[model samples]
Target: MTTIDVKSRFEAKLLRPAKPGNDTSWAFVVLPRDASEQLPRRGRTTVEGTINGHHFQATLEPDGQLSHWLQVSGELLEAAGTAVGGMVTLELAPVKKEPEPDIPPDFQEALAATPEARKVWNTTTTIARVDWIHWITSAKQLKTRAKRIVDACDMLASGKKQVCCFDQSGYYSKAFRAPEAESF
Candidate 1:
């Protein structure tokens, strides 16, 4: 891990997203194990920094292999003057403040429909909300996601403050991993 309190700088080769038919601009990179260890936590972490000298903020996802991965967006790619297959230098640190998550419409609507759950969700801290979202989106199957939504609502309504027994790191659960890179 990079030295504490000092920004971590490293070079990473960009790669294609795991799925086919993705937009050309959608790419990703896996942070080296050592760099990932510099983070404050093993779970999903929000980071603010620059890629190729262009300012950007994004959340890094746990690779489930005890590493971290980042999805590169089009705007970020353009601003940084890089693309898939490009090796770019990055300087990163955990964002001091958590940014609002882009919640899925389905989850949003579910929260809206359940007054009790909405009450709990609204009162929960943003970090907790992030965890709730991570749990929902981590589902590999649509049916599992749907069930998680229902369960989330139920748990919240019952006054559960966090997702119980969830392996946010994906390390112990083996339920998540960095998506497979597409064939070059």
Candidate 2:
């Protein structure tokens, strides 16, 4: 596919979770696999796009099955004059420079306790930190998450710049996935 094809500009219908939880306010859409395959990577790729002419930026999370999904905030939906179940056009491309990923409190605390790791972390690229955060946070179990934090600290202290053996796309390990939304 051409670069333009990989950019994945297309239309999709907005959807909400069948049963709302803490995220009742958010709507979402899934990208077709073909469109997703055109992106730079399978993991979380930050993109700047317009939703029905309402400009916004977001990081597309891998859908565990080799595709990707995007969450549309209520504010964005309102700005775009779109709503859940509304069809919207999207024009997206990977951002030139990735913004820093939010560090979870537990991971931040762990880093604080390890001075060497904290120093290395401060020096790592924002994109690397993004992947590290994704790898650490994608763990399904609390114990797995805790272990990853400890391991991440050790690796960072040892001067590792990026996560090792992590499947960012979730296709190989099925470690990542799009959030569940209500089906039509």
Candidate 3:
């Protein structure tokens, strides 16, 4: 339950896609490095915070540049009546409970159509489910996403409980990798 409070302006930045051929419309707000360093974890952490007095619950994720940030959804910006460059008062505390992501309807239907996959999905922990959802949704193209959904269902039906060969925490993901220093 560590909490940190800071008053700063919201910084507008585009989150470049980690994978090539992915859409580049992802935008986010940069969290102050000073404040971000106070959190308990360097990776994604469930955070309950307020922006301009509007309460929000979100995950603070690493920005792949040794920094952390929160995604600024259009709803949040509208609710706060603030845009990208507006000054905001922020207060954040780590939430003890992990929040589950909403599964897309198509994905849900795919699981329903596959009983074996549904059984495996039901047995997985909340965090595991979240990771699966994140990986599937990370695909930028509709075709890719649909393919991922089918592949996920097939994998689960085959008794696999997690998304193999993927960095679930995103630490080693292309966007979050440590920069290579120039050789002497």
Q: Is candidate 2 or candidate 3 better by TM-score?
A: 2
Q: List the candidates' TM-scores in order.
A: 0.88, 0.89, 0.66
Where does model 1 exceed 4 Å of error?
1-6
User: Could you say which candidate leads in TM-score?
Assistant: 2
Query: Candidate 2: TM-score?
Result: 0.89
Candidate 1 residue lDDT tens string, 1-184: 2232336889999888757364766888899998899887778899887888777878999999888999898888888998889999988898888887888999999999999999999888877888899999989899999999999999999999899989888999998788789777
Better of 1 and 2 by TM-score: 2
Q: Report the C-alpha displacement of residue 177, candidate 2, in angstroms.
A: 1.9
Q: Candidate 3 regions off by >4 Å? A: 1-27, 33-45, 60-62, 73-82, 169-171, 175-184
Q: Decide which is better by lDDT, 1 or 3.
A: 1
Ranking by TM-score: 2, 1, 3
Worst 10 residues of 2 by lDDT: 1-10
TM-score of 1: 0.88
* lDDT (CA) per prediction: 0.87, 0.87, 0.69
Native-to-model Cα distance after best TM-score fit, residue 154 in candidate 3, in Å: 1.8
Q: Please give, for residues 85-164, the per-residue lDDT of candidate 2 as tens digits.
A: 89999888788788888999999999999999999999999978999999888888999999999999999999998999
Position 42, candidate 2: lDDT: 84
